[model samples]
Target: MSNNHGRVINFGAGPSALPEPVLEEAAKGLFNFQNTGIGIAEISHRSKEFTSFIANLESLIRKQLDVPPTHEILFTQGGGSNQFSAVVLNMLARWRLLHPEAPAEEAVMDYVVTGSWSKKAMEEAKRLGGGRVNAVADSRQFSQTGKAFDNIPSHDAYKFSRDPALIYYCENETVDGVEFSHEESSPAAFPFQLLGQSTEKQLLPLVADYSSSFMCRPIPRLADHAIVYAGAQKNIGPAGLTVIIARKDCLVDVDAAARLGAAPVPIMLSWKTLSDSKSLYNTPSVLSIYMTGLVLERIDSLGGLKYFEDLNRRKASKVYAAVKEGQDRGVFQKKVKDGSESWMNVVFEVFGEGAEKRFLDGAEKKGMKGLKGHRSVGGIRVSLYNAITEEQVDTLVTYMNDFVAEETKPKAEQ
Candidate 1:
């Protein structure tokens, strides 16, 4: 720990910080997993060693989140971006089957745009899925909650024609350094979902692009509607892996023609093929799976989802309170509505232009790093992931307040 370089507090986004235990555990077994001669990285994925590794990750995710019996989790390659097309293709395949009479070439899709990624996802759906993607409220900056999307999805459109897969969103935008709080269910003061129409049988699947906050909190239950997918970079393990959680029905309904067609998908991106083999498609990323297993195990030891939920609340509270208190004296600034605050990433603009730069410089001098905001939105973002400790946040706050106090000193005295 003493020899650790870089920022004392790593606030960088994805490919960002990982829990120390996960790293240590992986290191311990790198050369030999469970006393096996071969290192996790060198072993053949088909071997029993790798099979156990995959099983551990699956079991951990199920145990921690208590995944339902109906759902199956598959580990695939290519990030969430790749799934953007795959989801539409798979989902639209299911969609078309449900509504055979509707125009398959020209369908209408809805997107609850919260940030850049969701917005991009919606755009991709239109280009690839070949449909009308209605973007709900869209903004340049990332947001947990803000103004309602201009055109609330019309439940009636789906009521009459093929029910457009009315998609909603929940992504912790790390770019602007803003993320979601609250559990999958409750919202003490305010709840997010407001499905205007009756989402019974006609309702399409809820495709959520949960990239950053995938494992930080409890798995959200999208009212028993759709499916969830995420890339395993930040919280899960490695960068090359992507995990998709979908209902068995979702798979059973995929176009049969494509399932048994003349085309051949090079074995890496094929979810159906991988799922059939229990994620042992081709020499899988044994090292990545082993790494993810360690992470899942570490999270389980911390008392599972509820425990981490409370723990996340405490960690986020430290930064939020500090920022709010400073803002009162006209120092720190809130970029969005205070009511719609985030628990994972805390983002705020400085009161003045130079203040932002000054604060970054001062913080760096004190061993704090990764406080810089994303390139798209220039502000400070403090990303508090599952592994981030309470003390690190406290230290960050202390520096923030002290810097504010120091800058406000009477100019005449100097």
Candidate 2:
């Protein structure tokens, strides 16, 4: 094992830190995979080894999440946001197919915009659906912090379910440091009829973008008539490949997934074509698939979803403590909600304008990297993904406190 070299606490939000072992395995496989004399980079995606790899990845995802038989797990290119186009295309096509008599105006999608990614998803859906879209919480803001709204059955959403509108939401916001820990408890389920709704209940399909936090825990029960998608770069294999877990009904939508019938649609956007060939539509990225398999295998060996959730909570708690340590010393304060904060991203802001800049500079000099917050919402963000360690977080905490003390000079200096 290579020493961390004090270069620790890599906190980039997506394409974030991956497990060391996964990286090691990938490095080894670069030259040869499974005794094959060729590098994984050279193997054909259609080769048996690659096929087995893809199958295993799909199986692991399904088994870990306990996704229903009705859901189709697909590996294709395009980030989770691409599903914004995929979902609207497939879903609207189905809606039109189901309610042919309904006016074009009535084919509306209800989106709950909680943060940046959700807003983008809403935009994509509207454009794909051709101006027919309805959004809830079309936007949200945190007041003095503490809570990011209870995702569980908001009074408004539950009330709106009566007549029904196509419901959509981002399961978790990667940028804002908010996550829906439980769909059953989340307002997302409100669009679908609850146990209390009468048998004549009319509910919208509960669609969502489960990108950053997808597969971090067990899949939810009330997520019916839903099409969930994720980008692999964050917690999966790599970028440029988005995985969509669709309820069977959503997969057949022609626009939702480009159908080239084996010819390969543009070599990039054809999800249906990719799914049909088990992701071999053209040549898949072998190293990406191989790394995904090794990662999943490691996850399986560590115990499955139940084990991961506990581990993730612990890691997140450690990161939270680090941020709090900075605050307790008057260096920075968290901006996200108390209980709803994301396990993957911890966001905070320094009190003074120059404070953030000074702290980031110190952190980098101390050997930490990628601690900068995203440009859209800048401050300081520490993304503690699955691979981040408690020791690393502790180091960050220690350094943060020291840096804060160093920066707090007397007013005479000002």
Candidate 3:
């Protein structure tokens, strides 16, 4: 039996396509890592070999992201979803220490809801029994339909608490295809410019979920953030490992917070636990970490993020151009507002009876897969993660243009 299967152009949102070179490199690790007879999956987490590898993985992220010394990089098991609850608990711990006499009601967590993921994070904060979860700015508020979260709200739309425990935002909304502008001064950029004007004037603790867009581009003002985390599945490696870049100050004493009337933080969920133990607190996703390390090495070898950013911009430009052309032809409709369009996930609709299925079928026949939109939102979502090449994007764009031309072509000609 042949052990090889040719890969398709995968546009999945997560557990998404990885670089072919990285995959090939990782395959060797499954059988033997660095000639150690034991495979990476079978290696002991405490072994020096594994320990050194994990350390290098953390260093790669720090070097790539330009993480400052004030922050520490830690690895954990749960994906971004797990952090939804952990973030609240941990941030609340810090708040409790700072405001020992303040009531729980006084604690506030401002969440900027731009898409499904942020909405879910807000819901998790509410469920975690932390400070009040305030929807400071909801993109849906500006939605013409009043329900769709298809864009980032203007800077003035954010209504942050005076002394909030934490300000939370998702840098990229994977499901709804919304993203903040990388430009710092633009209204479309991260709300930092607006936050600077807050009456409090204190630098509020900020946390961001960068699950889908991590390592895709440079993070603006990254050092100022209290915490930033992303799951390795997208643009990196497999699921199970989540990389957290946390400021030392944010890793507060949860026990101290418990004494101050806050709920006890779970040991496993504690950032301090991971940071103190160097991410070797307990059994970790060994294989996932190993694969992610390989991916990072591959990125470094390929001229780092600058190269990827340029490649990604070009790829996204091509697809969005096709989308615009289709819109003009009345063959497609865009889901995101201008400037808020996600570089990682470009969502749109194909107009006509059974057009969506026809689009999927045509793409599948041409070797594209995972173009289907998320279940909650029906339509097409083209995920242009780092692994997706320019050539693959060109193929998709050509198919898109051809599809639109076919759909708009005269019936008499057919």
TM-score, per-candidate, Cα-based = 0.86, 0.85, 0.97
Worst-scoring 10-residue span by lDDT in model 1: 148-157
Better of 2 and 3 by lDDT: 3
True-structure lDDT of candidate 1: 0.66
Clashing pairs in 3: none
> Which candidate leads in lDDT?
3
Arranged by lDDT, best first: 3, 2, 1
Model 3 per-residue lDDT tens digits across residues 23-111? 88888989999899989999999999999999999889998889999999999988999999889999999889988999899898999
- Please give, for residues 1-414, the per-residue lDDT of candidate 2 as tens digits: 126433455778878777887887888888988888878888878778878878888898888888778777777766776677766655655565555566666656667776778778888776655336665553353343423432222435432332333567776777877676564554433334342352222334567777787667765663464577778777766666667777665544354322321111243454455556666776655666678778788888889878778877787887687678778877778876555677777888888768888888888877688888888778888877666666677777788777767656677864
Candidate 2, residue 150: Cα displacement in angstroms equals: 12
Model 1, 27-87: lDDT tens digits are 8788787888777777778777678778878878877767787788888777888887777
What local lDDT does model 3 show for residue 250? 89
Instruction: Check candidate 2 and list the clashing pairs.
Output: 151-186, 151-187, 152-185, 152-186, 152-187, 153-187
Local error of candidate 3 at residue 199 (angstroms): 6.9
TM-score of candidate 3 on Cα atoms, chains taken together: 0.97
